[model samples]
Target: MSKIIFVNLPVSDLNASMAFYEALGFENNPQFTDDTAACMVWSEAIFVMLLTHDKWKTFTNRPISPITTSEVMLCLSCESREIVDELNDTAEENGGTADINPKQDHGFMYNRNLADLDGHVWEMMWMDPAAMTN
Candidate 1:
C-alpha cells in the first residue's frame, strides 16, 4: 500500500512549476525528478506530484479541468497567520496571483486564497491548535 498522499497537478512548465512550489517552502524529491513530472514534498507523508500537461494526459483520457472551470481547490494548512501570509507572498513573487479577497482573521483561524500561474486555486490558511477545542 502507498503510504504517502500524492496530489497531482497538471502544469505547463516543469521548471516554472518547480520554482513556484519551492518558493512555498516545498522540497523536490530528486528520486522522482524527471522531464515530465516532479515530486514535491510538503511533509514527510504529504506530497504534490506535478506533471506537465503532456505527462498528465497519459493517466486519464477524461478532459482536464481548465483552472477557471475546474471544481477542485487545493487546501493547505499552515502553523500560523504569519505562515499564511508568507506562503501567499511567495506565490505572488513566483508569478502567482492573489486571486481572492484577503483573509478573514477570526482570531483562532486565518484564511486566504491564491491562484497559481496555471490559475489553480490554493487555500492558504492557519488555525490555532489551542483554539480548536474552544
Candidate 2:
C-alpha cells in the first residue's frame, strides 16, 4: 500500500474555493463532494478536502485562522519554471492573489507563492533534475 495525503482546508465559500483550485489544475472528485465539502485531487496521491466553516468546526473546535495570517504554506513541485509561472498566473486569474511573497530564483531552482481565495498559501516551485545530482 502507498501513503496518500489529504490536506483539509476550511473555506469560507466551498464552490468558489473549488473553482479556485480547479484553475490551478486540481480536479474535483464529485464522489466525495457535497454541499458542505469538496474533494479536490491534485495528483494520484495528493488530495485537498475543502470544508465549509460549519463542517470545519465539526472536525476541530479551534478557531479558523484569519486570512491575513498563514498557518501553513503548501508547496507543489512543477515540471519546469514555466509551469510554475503558469500555475501562479492561473491562480491569479481565478480570484487568487499572486506573488504574496517575493519570487525566489536560483540557477537550479525557481519558486513563487500565491494565496487562494481563503488566503491559503501555495508555493509553486521547480528544480532542475540535473542539479539534484550535484
Candidate 3:
C-alpha cells in the first residue's frame, strides 16, 4: 500500500474550511468526518483533514502559527493557467484571501497564492509539460 497521508493543518472553523476546500473542487470523505474534522479527498491517494484548531492540537504540543505570521506556504499544481486562476477565484469566492505575491508567468509556469481561513498560504500553479522538455 502507498504511504499516503497529507497533513491536516488546523483551522479555526471546520465548516468554513470544509466549504472553502469544497469550492476548490475537493470532495468530502464522510468516512473520516466528524464535527471537529472533515476528511477532504483530493484524489484516491491524497487527502486533507480540515480540523478545528482545538481538536487538532491533541496531536501536537507546538504552537499554532497565526496566518499573518506563518512562514510556510503550501503549493498545489494545476493543469493550466486557466485552472490556476479558476481555483484562486473560487477560493476568494469561498472566503480565502489572496497572498501579496503577484501572479507569475514564467512562460512555462504560472502561479499565484491564496491564504485560507486560518491564514495558511496555498500556492496555485500550472506548468506546461512541453516547456519542461529541453
Clashes of each: 0, 0, 0
RMSD after Cα superposition, model 2:
1.1
Per-residue alpha-carbon lDDT of model 2 for 1-134, expressed as tens digits? 69999999999999999989988989999999999999999999999999999999999999999999998999989999999999889989999999999999987899999999999999999998687644
Tell me the whole-model lDDT of each prediction, alpha carbons only.
Answer: 0.85, 0.94, 0.84
> What would the TM-score be for candidate 2 when compared with the true structure?
0.96
- Local error of candidate 1 at 77, Å? 1.4
Residue pairs with backbone overlap in model 2? none
TM per prediction: 0.89, 0.96, 0.92
Please state the error at residue 87 of candidate 2 in Å. 1.0
* Best prediction by TM-score: 2
Q: Candidate 2 at residue 64, lDDT?
A: 99
Per-residue alpha-carbon lDDT of candidate 1 for residues 5-124, written as tens digits (9 for 90 to 100) = 899888988899999988889999999989999999999878989999999999998777876764677888988788898888888888988745566778788888888778888888
For candidate 2, which ten residues in a row score worst on lDDT? 125-134
